[model samples]
Target: MTTDHIGDVTKAFIDYVDHNALHAVAPENVLIEAFLNATAAEAAEVLAHLEDDDIERHLPRVIVHLIRRLAAAHKNPTPDAVAYEAQNPNLGIANQPSHLRIVKYITDVYTSQIKGDLWSVAERVAADAYTRRVGEDCERLAQIALTNVTAAELEHHIKTNVERWRDHGKRLRRITNHDNAPTNLKAVA
Candidate 1:
């Protein structure tokens, strides 16, 4: 996607958070900073605006989904792909064992079957096998390719995100007075 598209998506995400009051639920600055410095405050602001229940249930899933999507988009072959190339005769020779080179070889195999663009049926099948065998290992590695994040980083992320949410809860209680609301107002109001 273009930079403009990414920016637009980011803006829309922020707007969604604001509209939902996620910031009131989960101030996300620290967690956001952990992901990307530019989106830190904006992400926190968005998280702060969500409902507590919604934030608890959905935020982690959203983050994981985003990570997975990014990972898939930038995914290249892994060491397994190199091994596959080494074993396969029709794939020819590969002097180096680099991930990109292996991925290219896989892509060539994929493209050959389609008779069109460089797509990889073999790679897809292998990916499926990897998913079954490694149980998200390839996907995790793929996500790592998209960002410099690590499992240890994610542990920090969990802690920060939780703290932000808790802080938002405290702030929300201090900011709102339920008893002072007009009696005539509906519960949904």
Candidate 2:
């Protein structure tokens, strides 16, 4: 599906956090750092080791593992971390795994699908509309994770996204002829 707008909005949200949040100043923040350093190529390299069918099923787990290892290695340097650092010296994490690169790759893949681009227009609109709402919440979570926030608070924050998603559909319907979008979109009118 054509998700170019989706990627554009997603990048906007990330840029907002990177530019405005406390994490922007704190390079030591592992979550943000890993995200900033992650690339599609790294994710592709990890997938090269996996069977095609397993890629989607195991991608999230691989990302989590890479992040956790990143944090672990940063907290306590090890030989494996050194080896990984050699490969991804910019990451400043121990045992830099190619799996780490897959994090951002998830969004890139969304924008690459051509067959269903028309169907995804509403999604892109929704994303563009709600970028700041989502970005602020994410920034808040990242900031609080470094200090204080209850599990219940965290759960509430996460649950709010579901409602926002619903709202996106509603807004798209109100704002545009999303349901009847042309089957084949062209850049020029």
Candidate 3:
């Protein structure tokens, strides 16, 4: 896909994340700027090489990692700054316990909805549900610009996921019914 398309998709994914209530520790705008700044044509090319199955299986991890990095950036302005300083040891080693807890929470919530074999339609449905919720929350955050939240970050997250699903096309639709099916009629007795 072209860079413009990729950017559009990224935006949609971020919007989806904001629509959902899932909280990211990082400021939304900063996170989004970071993602946009880090991602390039090469990143999209790398994503393109991924099979649908792989994308489906690993998207959650990608999202979690992205959120973690964003959160870290928020807590630690400098590269050497420690994240979650409250957990830092006397020796100055930052305690990873809080980070781990947050990561675990994100994984738990994401996987709970997207669990099961990739081939299963239920898994796709679950993944859609998960993404949809995230999008909704992101949108909400964007609208309100809640304290400690950044609209841009939430928008970026939603855009990314939306793009992924759009790229998968048939694979995603196969697991979903976007249009309402026609109802069957009963014969008059």
Candidate 4:
């Protein structure tokens, strides 16, 4: 959530790379400036670091490490974390749509519900829980969209929630216009 954590993550990445035998072609090796600046023996240093397997087994390890970091990084961010400075975790959190936000909020709670938090096992349980939540939420939102809010109901709700009332007005108003929307707005439920 904090920019300070980037250095730790960078160190983590470097440590993982240093320990594992990924056949990495360092960025310096790609450019002509690197070739021209370096001595002939510099290439030897590069060769020494690279893992020389025909299969390049370490490549998969690098991918797994990336995924692991991502999973680790996906720790739930608070609303205020992104307010001052825009960064990762923040970007990841900010970009999620409201529909997904509803599902994620519910699923995240379900995941963290039992005995504090277990990241791995929680994900599995949350997956099952999320599926059901999404389905139910989708059906409910669909039903809500179809149903018209009575004028008195809208007025009463607007006192508490003007923005939400406006959104409902927009949704209903669209369906009310025969030229704009083909489907009828009225619903029994």
- Misplaced by over 4 Å in model 2 are 1-125, 173-180, 184-189
lDDT top scorer: 2
- Per-residue CA lDDT of model 4 for 66-183, tens digit only, reads 2223334442222122111122333333233343343342233323313221222222222333344445545765565566966676455435454534443443343334231224
TM-scores of all predicted structures = 0.19, 0.26, 0.20, 0.18
Residue pairs with colliding backbones in model 2 are 1-116, 1-117, 2-117, 81-95
* Model 1, TM vs. native: 0.19
Residues 108-129 of candidate 3: C-alpha lDDT, one tens digit per residue: 3433333222123232333554
C-alpha local distance difference test of each model: 0.36, 0.42, 0.40, 0.33
Q: Indicate the worst ten consecutive residues by lDDT in candidate 4.
A: 26-35
Deviating ranges (above 4 Å) for candidate 3 = 1-98, 106-115, 121-168, 173-189
Off by over 4 Å in 1: 1-146, 178-189
Instruction: Show model 4 residue runs off by greater than 4 Å.
Output: 1-118, 150-189
Two-way lDDT contest, 1 vs 2, winner: 2
Whichever of 1 and 4 has more lDDT, that candidate is 1
